[model samples]
Target: MSSSSAPTSGTLTYDQAGVNYDLIDPLKVSAQRAAAATASHLASHGFTEVAASRGESAYVVDVGPFYIASIVECLGSKALVADEMATLTGRSWYDGIAQDTIAMAVNDLITVGATPLVVQAYWAAGGSDWFGDAQRAQSLVAGWKKACEVCNVAWGGGETPALAGIVEGGRIDLAASCTGLINPKERLSVGDRLQAGDAIVLLDSSGIHANGLSLARKLVERLPEGWLTEIDPVNHPGLTYGAALLAPTVLYSPVTEALWQAGIVPHYCANITGHGWRKLLRHPATLTYRIHTVPPVTPVLAFIQQHAQQDDREAYSTLNMGAGFALFMAPEDAQRTVEIAQGLGIGARIAGQVEAGPKQLLIEPLGIRFGDDDLQLR
Candidate 1:
């Protein structure tokens, strides 16, 4: 057998790798317009007390000692995969995707140092498939309830739509809106407290943690039949490699609560979603996040690397690479942070440290450095 070579189409870009630029562009434009309109409205209404504001996937309203934050997220292409998985495993359709739907919203809030309070999901189903439809709706509610319970959040209820023509058999679109509260004094901001000598804490991820699936599916489609039939060599688990890839995303409430109790405020916290560590460097000044030690390579990630012919750097940049959350803290508080996370039964480790100038990420011993190209979003 011969080895496969990397795609030679000129430094494979993210959009070329299957991220839908056309679909995302309109949404981006609309978001910008909406943000401007909202700001104008607020100003016109004489709401001048608001301290700061920025718009992206969510909006934040500053109110005195605390800030009210909201996030909205939809079940991307993974909804189709979830349907397939459910049919294959004889599980409820919504059962597999509901947790991720909630996590997507709650985690976004957490990245801004907000504590999630209430979660609401909106779902639309179709056809006369009452059995599947009812099961999916019920499973979604149960899943959200379970997630909220674990996160110490409350279920604020939501809307369910039954559209016969708009949705097809076994088809559903799920989305969520979450509200959170954060003390302005305690809110973590980029570059405010982050500095050189600050240690980085990495919280272990359960699996892919709900990003990069479009590329993952493309790669899987090109693979030979029964590629994931065998058990993974690393972390030998009973499930097939593909099955393990479906592991649910890790919830951060426990870790956040632990840090809150320990009074170990992070200088910066990143959810490590879609863009990985790139999201962590959204600060003003030049900064470098040196990841020295990483969580042990899980079987799923190892399989992806080997099969996709991707290097460690590409894998880490594209996926969570085993760490779900990256927290920047003072060197003195590193041990305490790890202890608190561990005490809460969450896997935590010292992944790296911050440094001055040369705004680039370096992986020690390996001598691998990632620059703007590697971290930049297309």
Candidate 2:
């Protein structure tokens, strides 16, 4: 299904809301450069760094028989939304918040075909009093354990610091780092196998998966009822806007593991996070991604676009829309991938293909095309 475009007037783009990638990307480039210089230091520990993996989702290290992949990610501003929604709904949402934090890190780790082994939590609060609520604190602990089980990773100990001045007193900042293993050596995927004619299989996301919450929160301010607003008054009654926004992110580590167990090695994979659909072309290669179809967007996302006055390009560039993760593999393996995900009770579909052309993405259904300039993660 396609999203209806709102008129240009009063358009609420992501940058206007607070996040300006133009300013953020340059720092990424700087970090990548600085990080590259430190790669040589690894040899002292008898480990060789995978130079090509530097700018990828997960960093890889050659440790003799297998590679170790690691990624650190945060839940962004979604936690703040959960805090507000909890006050409005009179229910603790920290379980989903904990899950969202782990998913953010684990999802990125799995893109390289790594099986997550351990996840370390980083929960920082403005004050120690933030954890004084028994219900909220216990929900967070239980949720973290549950999400770790879902990802098949150990909940390694983490630090919960009380930074009174740095963080807002009422809110806590959530983040995590995941370390995974890529065994059998052949399981590693960093787009080296990507080629023309590869089919693009998309995995469905459960609502907004912790990427565009900043803009989502901004959109909520314009609503008359704010967090208490019903997402779809006629169809999905009682589903408040806050409840929809707080939906836990889908953990994709199992899906990647299932694909490997089925002998389907995706040429490349991407966790559709901050960059939105532009992430489809994230592999640093000169190829054109032609998407013939898109997944059905969730009602909350549709509501955000319609209410925020975001056009097709703006909405597609900012939010997941519906497709959370992408897998590019041989055309023959595409259906098998979809079936494997479906077997796991997750939505999947063959959405597009890669063609030999310039580095760009063409969403045929929406006539939206994003050039290489749109994404600058490297």
Candidate 3:
């Protein structure tokens, strides 16, 4: 867990750690505008783009009888924590990284009311011998396939390229792409039915899933033992910081599938990832998202908050804060959604309801409000 890097400042910010959304957001906006222009190109191929899906988590295209949703997501820098852990613990955590890759992709795809059909992996290594470690390679493959099977998706073949100049030695970057199906079309939950009366159902997260690892890793440099530092003993027992952060992301596909089986189609579904709870305002409607509750913060995240000195606003705006997915549906389906999630061994509850105001998210418990300007995903 030791490194040559200097100890970081006591107080840290995500932008200071090198990922500045302000600089990166405009690029995303420009890319979206450019990609939107290419939508008409799909029409000639016997498919038409779902206009509302343009700025959504996944891309949905209609091909006459059925619709297909696609998403490509990376594991981000979380793999770096696993690399450090392997050095200290002598155990490879790539299996969890593999699961995180699948969770990142399919979670986005299911939000478009699509059932994941197949997933393709992308493993790019800096050195040719990155996969020479037989155990790590086998664990990655086993985890990826198991995640796909749990999501009821097939493991589509993928590519592994060794890029000399593109990547760094002893490091492997992980990402995946998933294609899903929305058959009969009525199950789509792209916010088309979202309205003021809809209730918001929130699902619990498995601590620090997939987002904010850059900031977390940077915080490691500030710690005395880096990743080896044991986190909150009460919450994590004897687990080190690296082990806690590497906990695999929870896959939300099964929850969505359960909703479909019970005929409870959410008006809109959001996979709470990089944008945090601000993603509740991701829909294009002019409605306001009024959240009456904030789920209990996980201790691992609490440790980060205390260590990083982030305020409620800063913490809620950046991390999942125990809430992972948000579902907007008619008020009658609110309790039912929670039941479905609980039946599937997931924690969930009716968090709030929508309002007729302008597009915004109001967290009543914390008195924090995020206007449309706050969430600029498009």
Which one is best on lDDT? 2
Write model 2 residue lDDT over 157-225, tens digit each, in one string.
999999998998888989999999999779989889999999999999999989888778777777889
Model 1 worst lDDT run, 10 consecutive residues: 1-10
| Clashing residue pairs, backbone N/CA/C < 3 A, model 1 | none
Candidate 3 lDDT by residue in tens digits, 1-378: 223343355567666667656778788888988999999999789789999998888999999888989989988988898898999998788889999999999989999899999999999998789989998898898888889878999998898999878888989889999998997699877878988999999999988999989878878877787788889877567888889999899999999998988988889999999868888888888998888977888777888888888887888888999998999999999998999999988899899999899888999999998898978776
For all candidates in order, the CA lDDT equals 0.69, 0.90, 0.87
Candidate 1 lDDT tens digits, 290-356: 8888787666766666666667667767777778888888988898989888887778999899998
- Tell me the TM-score of each prediction against the true structure: 0.86, 0.96, 0.96
1 against 2, candidate with superior lDDT: 2
Better of 1 and 3 by TM-score: 3
Q: What RMSD value applies to candidate 3?
A: 2.1
Sequence-dependent TM-score of model 2? 0.96
Total clashing residue pairs per candidate?
A: 0, 0, 0
Model 3 stretches astray by more than 4 angstroms: 1-10
- How many times do residue backbones clash in model 2? 0
Candidate 3 Cα lDDT to native: 0.87
